[model samples]
Target chain A: MLERSHIQSTGFRNVGPVGERTGFELRLRQANYRGTRLSLIEGVTITVDGVLYPAAHNLVRIGSRVYTPAELDAATETRLAVGEYMTVIVPRPGGLAPGVHWVESAIGYRHPYFPPAHQSAVARDARHATIVMA
Target chain B: MTGFRYGVSLYSYTDDLGTVMTLDDAFDHVADTGATGLEILGETSVPLYPEPPAAWLDHWFAQLERYQLEPTNFACWVDTRIQLDRKLTVAEGAEQIALDLRLAHRLGFKFIRPKFGVIDYNLTPDPIWEGAVERNLDLAQALGIIILPEIHAPTPIHHPVTEGYIAFIERTGTRNFGLMLDTGIFQDRPLTAWGGGDIEAIRKDAPDMVNGIKVPVEHLDDIIRYVPFIQAKFHHVDEDLHDHQIPWERIVPRLKALGYAGYLSSEYEGVRDPWVAIEQVRRQHALIRRLEAEWEAQHA
Candidate 1:
C-alpha cells in the first residue's frame, strides 16, 4: 500500500493587518512508501473554508523551487523516492478573517502499480488561530 | 486454545494526529478499552528518537503504570535507500536498526516492527536488507528485542522475500528475527469505505490493479509459528461490529487452533472520520475477546 505519514501544518499566522491580504504557510512531508519512485503529478491542494487552492500557484514553494500553477502542472517528471520526504510550502493570500478558521491540504498523485488511477492523501488542521491585527 | 491478548497501536488514531488526540489521549483510549498492551510508532509517538528527555520518560512510564498497559511493539523505520540521491551503506542501515533496538529496549518493548526499504509496490525487501539485518543480529540478541518485518498487504505470504526471511532464520537459528503478519493479507473483499458502492465495479474499473490481497486462510497454519505478533489491520468495521472485508471469523479460529498466542494489535487504516475510527478499534477488541472466548469453549 502507498502511504504518506507525519503530515502537519506549521508556522500558521496572520501575514498582515486586518483589512489587508492575509494568508498562512503550509508545511507537509510527503514520502513514497511504494518501493519505486512514484511521480507526484500535482503537488497538493489547500482548502480554506470550502475554497480550493492548488499547489501550482506562483506562491507555492516546494523545497527550494517556486512554481506557478502552469509551471508545476507542466513539469514532466517529479518522482519521490521510497523514504524521502518532500516538504511543501503553500502561501495563500487574501480574505482570512480573525479568530479561528478551518484549513485542509491534500496531495494527489499517480503510482505505477495502479495505473490510470489517481491516489490522494489529505491532512486537516482545525483551530487555526488568526489575529485581526498582528 | 491460545490465550490471545488484544492491544491498540497508536497508529490506529492517525486521522487525529496532533488535532484531536495527543499521545496521552491515545493511552487513555487504549486503557479505556481494557487493552493490556500498547504499540507505538517510534518516530511519531515518541517525543524524541534515540533519546527522550528524562522527564518525558518519567511521564511515559507513569502513564503506563497508571493505565496498567504493557508496551508491545515499537514500530521503527529501516531506511536504507530513502535518499533521493544515493543509497546508504549497509553499516548506515544497520546503525539505524540498532538505534531503534536500543530505544525499544530502554522503553521496555521486546518486539520491534521495522518497515524495511522496499524495492517494489509489492514490498519486496531491499537487497541490502539481508546484510543490514545480519549485521545487527548480535545487537538484537544483546538488547533482547525481536525484529519482525511486517508481511503486509499486496505482499503475499509465499513471496520470495518472505521465503528468504524464513530461510535466514533457519540458517542462523536466530530467534531475534521473525514476521509480523498483517491481517490485510486475509482481506476477502474490497473495503466499501475505500472503494465506493460495488466491490466488483471498483475491481472492474481498475482491471489491472488489485483492491485487496487474499492469502488462503489455511496457509496461515504453515507460518503462524514464526509469527509472534499480528497486526489486526482493518479498514472498516460496520455498526454491527462486523468487519465485512477481512475473514476474521476463519482466521481467528485458525490462530486459536494453532495455539498461536500473540498480540493482535488493532491497526485501523480506514478512511472514516477520526471519532468513528476510534470506536471501530474498540469494536475490534470486543470482537477479538468474543472470538477468543468462543474458541476456548469449543476446544475445552
Candidate 2:
C-alpha cells in the first residue's frame, strides 16, 4: 500500500572518477498494493558538480540502495573536486514494485559533453526540459 | 489480422525452472495450448548476476528457432538494490545493459521490459535517483535498444520515471526510449494484500475489476504514441468462460488503431499453482488471438 515513501541520508560519497561521476545510496522497505508490488519511490536524477544530469542515465543505481532518489556524488553536481560527497536516494531493489527489502543507489558520472581540451567550453543549453509521463 | 499471436512470460516459473520446463519446453507448452509466441523473462532465459559468458547467446537463439516461437520481448531489469545501493559502478551497469541488449538482439526481441526505481519501504528515489536512470538509459541507447520503463502498480503511471521519460526524450530526442505498458495497472481493485486474503477468491472476484490506478486512461491519445510495446499482464484464466479483467477487448482495439504491431506478451503472476497457472497463460493467449481477429475483421 506504500507507493511513494520518502527517504533521507547524509555523508554519502561521490564515487565517480571525477567529482562529476560521484553519487549516493539509500535503503528502504518494500510494500504490496492490490495484488501488485510497489516501491518506495520512482527514479533518481543526478547533477554533477553543478550540472544537472539531463537524463536518468549515469544517474541513480537501482537495487543497491534502499530508497528512490538514492545516491548523490560530487561528479553528479556542478564542478566539484574529488572526495567531495553528495546525496542520493532511490525507492528499493524491485523498482517501485512491492515485496522486498532492497536498496537503490544513484551515482553521477560527470558528463563532459564538452571535450576536455575545450577549456573555454560553454555548456550547451538543454534544448528543452519537461517532466511528463512517456 | 496478422493472427495477433499470443504468449506466456517466463517469469511465472521463476522458482522451479528444472521441474517446470526449460525455455524451449515452455515454448512447446505454449504451442500445445495453441499460443504462437513466447515472452522470456531475463532471469530464466539469460544468465544470472555477476554475468555469464557471451557464448550463451547462440544457445538461446537455437532454442528460439527450434521452438519456432517468435520472441515477444525481454524482461530486463535495473531495480533499486543493484543500481543504487550495490557497489557496482555505472560503467559496470552499462556493461550489463549492453550485454542484455545483445541478448535481446540475438534472440530477435525488439523491446526490453524493465521496471522503475527499486522498492524501498520508504517509497522515494535515492537522493541522486535521477542521475542513475539517466546513465542507464544512455547505455541502453548505445546498444541499439529501447529502455521501456514498466508502469506497474505501487509505482503508478504518475510516478517520476513515467514523467522523467518524457523529459528524457525531450532532452535527448531518442525514439529508442519509451514506455512498456502493463495491463495490471488498470485494474480497479486490490486483489489481496501480502499473504493475508484469498488469492483465488480475489482473482475470481475481480474478473472485471479496475483499480483505476494512475495509468492515464484519459491520456491514451497522448501516451499511446509513447508506448512501443504492451504486456497483457494476466494472473489466472477461466478456460471455460474465456475472460479476464486485463481489458484486452478495450486495449487491443486501441493498440491496433495506433498500428501497434509490437509485442503483446502475457505476464502470469498468480500463486495458485505454477504449472496450472502456465496453462491459464496459454488460454489467455488464445483469447487474445480471437480478440485480435475480431478487431481486425471490424477494421478491415
Query: What TM-score does chain B alone reach in each candidate, compared with the true chain B?
Result: 0.93, 0.77
**Residue A94 shift from truth in candidate 2, angstroms:** 40
- Candidate 1 lDDT over B32-119, as tens digits, reads 9988899988877665455678999999999999999999999986654433334557887788788889899988898998777666
Give the TM-score (vs. native) of candidate 1: 0.75
The per-prediction CA RMSD against the true structure, in angstroms, equals 7.1, 16.9
TM-score of every prediction relative to native: 0.75, 0.57
Instruction: Give per-residue CA lDDT, model 1, range A21-127, as digits (tens).
Output: 55655444433222222223345677767777676652545547655545554443333332234444445566455565566656544332221222233233333
Instruction: Estimate, for each residue in B1-300, the C-alpha lDDT of model 2 and write its tens digit.
Output: 444445666665432243334556666676565655677765445543224366766676676677677777777544334322343345554555566677676667767765333334213333333454556565566666776766555445666656766776778777777877777776553443212123443344332222325354544556777877777776545756344445666766776776777666676665533366566666777777777888888888
Model 1: residue B8 alpha-carbon error in angstroms: 1.1
Error of 1 at B222 (Å): 1.1
How many pairs of residues collide in model 2? 142
On the 0 to 100 scale, the lDDT of residue B107 in model 1 is 89
The best candidate in terms of TM-score: 1
DockQ of each: 0.11, 0.02
